[model samples]
Target: MSKIALFGASGTIGSRVRREALDRGHQVTAVVRDPRKITEEHPALTVVTGEVLDAASVAAVAEGHDVVVSAVGGGDGPGHQATIKPAAEVLVEGLRSLGTDAPRLIAVGGAGSLRTPDGAQVWDADGLPEFVLQIMHAHGDALDFYRTVGDVRWTCLSPAAQIEPGERTGRYRTAVDDLIVGADGQSRISAEDYAVALVDEIEDPRHVGERFTVGD
Candidate 1:
């Protein structure tokens, strides 16, 4: 079983990933700000309380892991959606301080930056709603940061345009640098399946130093 250090373990996608990892018999170190929020207890799971934006804190929790996954998201409040970039920066710095790049990093990214078949970014698509623009921009910045960073072996997994709580079919399709649309012409995936894809990638490395998207 691979050792995984997961940030934002109490969030929607993070929680799913944590469960999937444990179900697959992997050792998971779930890093969260509040340990009480994560009530799931597993023999293979270790909960660590720390700040994702602090380099030292992140590094301390990330030590001795085979892979690091960040499933962080912006909170409900307005303008709080831009934390992904800062968190990415801190994660990179923390990983670099380890003095060895053994633990590869994978981040849960937004689908707004994904490219359509016509080559237009989802963020720039016509008639896009204004409310989600900030979150999209933040995720775009985070993806850009990962793309440009050289020291860390990182990959950003962008989910389908519409992600929600649904059944885990343990099945999905993946595409690199472009959006994956279903037969019905919509891009979507369940949170549980997204976690499945992530843990699958963790077990077998693909899309290294790049971004990939998942869809039903």
Candidate 2:
């Protein structure tokens, strides 16, 4: 079983990812700002106080873990500009301090940078609110940062256009950069299934040192 370190474990997507990992018989360390926020109980789960933007804290929690999953700002909008890109930098910096023994990093990404069927990007679509644009761009910026780093073993998984709490069919399609549009012309994936894909990736390495998106 893989020893996983997870940031933002109290958030929507993070909680689902934690549950998925624990259900798969993996050991999970739920790192959060407030440990009391994580109310779930699992034999393989351990909650701890930590900050995603702090390299020291990241290193402390990341050491000895097989994978470090960051779900920070995965489904938020208010202050993503401050956390998303900065968190990416801190995570890489912390992991780099460990040299060659650092665990692999899997960061939750956004769909804004994905190319649409017409070749335009998702963030280029009209009628998007200003705050929504900020969050999307924040993730885009983080992805851009990840691409520049060749030393760290990192994988960014971007969700589809729409993601919310739903059933997990344990099935989804994936793409490297283009948006995965189904036959109905809609791009979407339930958060549960997204966790399934993330854990599946952890179990089987693919798209290493790159980004990929998922959809129903």
Candidate 3:
């Protein structure tokens, strides 16, 4: 089984990914600021208390793993927003310091930077809300940073326009550089299905060094 070091394990997406990974027989180290926040327990799971922004702490926990999945989210407050870039920067640096290239990194990204049918960015759509604009800008910045860093094998997986807790059908469509819309003209995917896709990718590496989107 592959060893995975997951940051932000207490978050929504991270927790789902942790469960999916463990269910697939992989060993998972859930890194979070508060250990009590994670309620689920599995034989293959180990919870560790740490900060993702701290390079030293990240490096310590990420030292020996087959893959690293970062599901950290941008906070609600204005000042706390724009966290993805900083967290990604520290994660890359921390993984590099380990002096090994075994573990590949996968980052859960946002859909704002994704392209529409007319080749326009979703974030740039007309009449977009101000709060959404802020988060999108940060996500765009984080994706941009990933594009420039070549020393590590990283993949940014952006979900559909709407993601929430739902059933795991294990059925979805994948696309690159553009948003995926269903037959109903809606762009969305269940969180469980997204986790399935992520774990599938973790087991079988594809779309490496690039960004891909998923939808139902």
What would the TM-score be for candidate 1 when compared with the true structure?
Answer: 0.96
Tens digit per residue, CA lDDT, model 1, 46-112? 9999888999997888888999999998465676666789999999999989877558899999999
Winner by lDDT between candidate 3 and candidate 1: 1
Model 3 Cα lDDT, one tens digit per residue, 1-216: 899999988887898899899899999999989999988878899999878898899888888888989999746557544577898898888877876564789999999999988898888888977877887787788889899978888899999988988999999999998999888988999989999999999989998899999999
Residue 119 in model 2: lDDT: 98
Q: Tens digit of lDDT per residue, candidate 2, span 1-216?
A: 999999988998999899999999999999999988988888899999999889999999999999999998744556666789999999999999988999999999999999999999999999998889999999999999999999999999999999998999999999999999999999999999999999999999897999999999
Order of candidate numbers by TM-score, starting with the best: 2, 1, 3
Off by over 4 Å in 3: 74-80
Backbone atom clashes (below 3 Å) for every candidate: 0, 0, 0
Q: Compute the lDDT of residue 91 as modeled in candidate 2.
A: 98
User: For residue 179, what is the lDDT in candidate 1?
Assistant: 94
| Model 3 error, position 103 (Å) | 1.7
Query: Which one wins on TM-score?
Result: 2
